[model samples]
Target: MSLGGESWRWLLASSSIPAIAVVLLRIGVPESPRWLLSQGRVDQARAVVERLRGNVEAFEDLVRNHVSARRVRYRELFGKKYWRNTAFGTIFYNAQVVPYFAIYTFLPLVLLKMGVGEEDTTSDGLLNLFLLAGSLGGLWLVAKMSRRGLTIWSFVFLIATMAPMAIWPDAPTALLFPLFLVFTFTMSAAVNLDQVYPPELFPTDLRSSGVGLLNGLSRVGSAIGTFLLPLALDGIGFSPTMLILTLVLVGGLVVSLLWAPETKNSTMD
Candidate 1:
């Protein structure tokens, strides 16, 4: 049933379909209402809000209270007022993604080391389901929980789930696999906040630039982690590598406690 030697080329090329679809779909998307309001386009912003079924009165209030017409330069993100946000965004994103990409990129090797065979398709399917469930759960919890609480607690649970395997790398497959699944679920859930937090952290004028900067930096971290993961596993072995990643999660927890803001019910302003 396997394909020819050129299968990798087709598989890689297939990704462009989604990319092209996104480009086409984005053509019809409206500009950000908040950004419009920031630019003094109150009527256009209100129209966008109304079309989206958002709170028009709130949008009006936002418009009325809008004071700044000055656009934020990228350098301002490093200024005193936004410096903590920049630091938090960069650290928080890297903390979540570094281990995330590293582990998932080499998941097969990870599972094999934990005694799961490549033939264990059922476990793979179950793990994917758990990831999906976790993502949905995260979306639900984003409304019910404070953003700070969710970010902190998710990091706490991620550390808890990972510490065991790091501490006992040779634990029984039964125990280790379940821990891995918990880690997967927690990671998937927490990753959703990546989409939520950065924009909220910045004002409308700076939002796009701030998010763009964070995303760019986060990808650098991901790239480095993905590249170094296999080398770490080879040189330091799985146990130490897991320990290192657990430390990274701990770093995330500390950063969240110190800097993650509660934007759950707050206005975009």
Candidate 2:
């Protein structure tokens, strides 16, 4: 558990060991009924559905006309029917990535620059504790509120919180520190939308592909943000860099307004 220096590398690698356990756990699990149905295994799908659910009749009716043995094509992602969903998911995922990755990557450095000590465990612990609380609160909101509303409002809060620090990078630590907490709170709360919506937005036929596309493309954005953040911070200073980030959030807000659909308590199309 030692996490210093190269020990962190071992800690990261050790995390993957659980995946092996998971693979073993999946050895006897039934294939997804929908996937079985898609493969034209109607009897197997029905049996799996009956085993998993008490009623197969309702599930059958729901998927009866929709289920097909036709092969899925990658081009469906770009086809007229799904191209908009694809764009929305990718933008939604990647927009959050740029800010989240950059900010968290340099959070410690930002704190140090603001006069907090490098080894200030108390400050870091408190931030993480509040982040967990925010995540739970977000889960509550995700179930009760419109996904689009939560996302738009969270981006607004993020832009508002970033404004002060961007406008006055040298503000007193007391005034600026709470801004960090608020930013973290909103960012954590808003993360549910980023994580949930992509899967919900796509139909079962394309769900995995859509989510994979979202994740894969967003990671590229994260990598770019992580790489460019330091350069931007050093070259442009905190205020202008933050101003640019604010604009990025604005773009997210606009996308959510124009394209994001509400999926809470709603049936998938």
Candidate 3:
């Protein structure tokens, strides 16, 4: 599904619009001295800070502080504190992706099946509107919320929202669309927050590995979740059907709340 021939040309042309990226860097771009020292380039980092800050004294102090943060023992990832964090992260992180993608990606079709269509009141416009609201709502939530905090809040919304769709299958349209609206909104927040949480929790040594393993495992769960939806929910009722899935979220949240530490303000080194 990659770009082929003319598609490649078209894509490069589309991607070449980088004037703003250059402008933004000129306006303000702070280099990480930690990045320099990690690569064994201390002198280069010092030069960068001196040039950027215009005062060698203050800049050197800041670089020293950055270097202190960089002194992480990679072995700590295998320690007790980090071990369960990695395991729980891999399990639930993978678990959430399953149901989330199944529902969110095919939501329009799901809505149509539930009765939003060309002949329906909004004539498919409702789904488009829901997506727009969802995109904006996520942007707003992420700006002010911790990844874990946002994840917990989203789970509350999902339990409240999805339960009704399953419980009251014949629920009125008036009741349903709001659930749809909120479902899309919260799903965006949940998915993004889940993706952001893991790497920050790990030290630099295993950070990428931890996130990559979690993400790779979650992609498998997503495939299975999609497979189950058609085979199960489509045939059975959506209410009792999601009981197991709901429990999975509850389990993930419980683990995260009790054991998943806050990482929003923590520096990753």
Query: Which candidate number maximizes lDDT?
Result: 1
> Which is the better candidate, 1 or 2, if ranked by TM-score?
1
lDDT of each: 0.89, 0.82, 0.68
lDDT of 3 by residue, 1-269 (tens): 14455786776677556866778767756556556656667788777777676667865665566543354555555577787877778666855676687776565556754566635656356656766776677777776887777777777777777777776767877787778677766665566666568877776656766777777878888888777775666677565556656666777767767666677877666
For each candidate, give its TM-score against the true structure: 0.93, 0.87, 0.71
TM-score of 2: 0.87
* Candidate 3 residue 132 C-alpha distance from true site, Å: 3.3
Tens digits of lDDT, candidate 1, 1-269: 15889998998999999999999999968988877777778888888899999998877777777796785578999999999999999999999999999999889889988889888898899789989999999888887888899999999999998998789988999999998899999899889999988889987778888999999999999999999999999999999999999999999899989998777767666
Off by over 4 Å in 1: none
Question: Lowest lDDT 10-mer window, candidate 1?
Answer: 63-72
TM-score of model 3 relative to the true fold? 0.71
| Candidate 2, 19-38: lDDT as tens digits | 99999999979987777777
For candidate 3, give the lDDT.
0.68
- Give the candidate number with the greatest TM-score: 1
Error of 2 at 104 (Å): 1.1
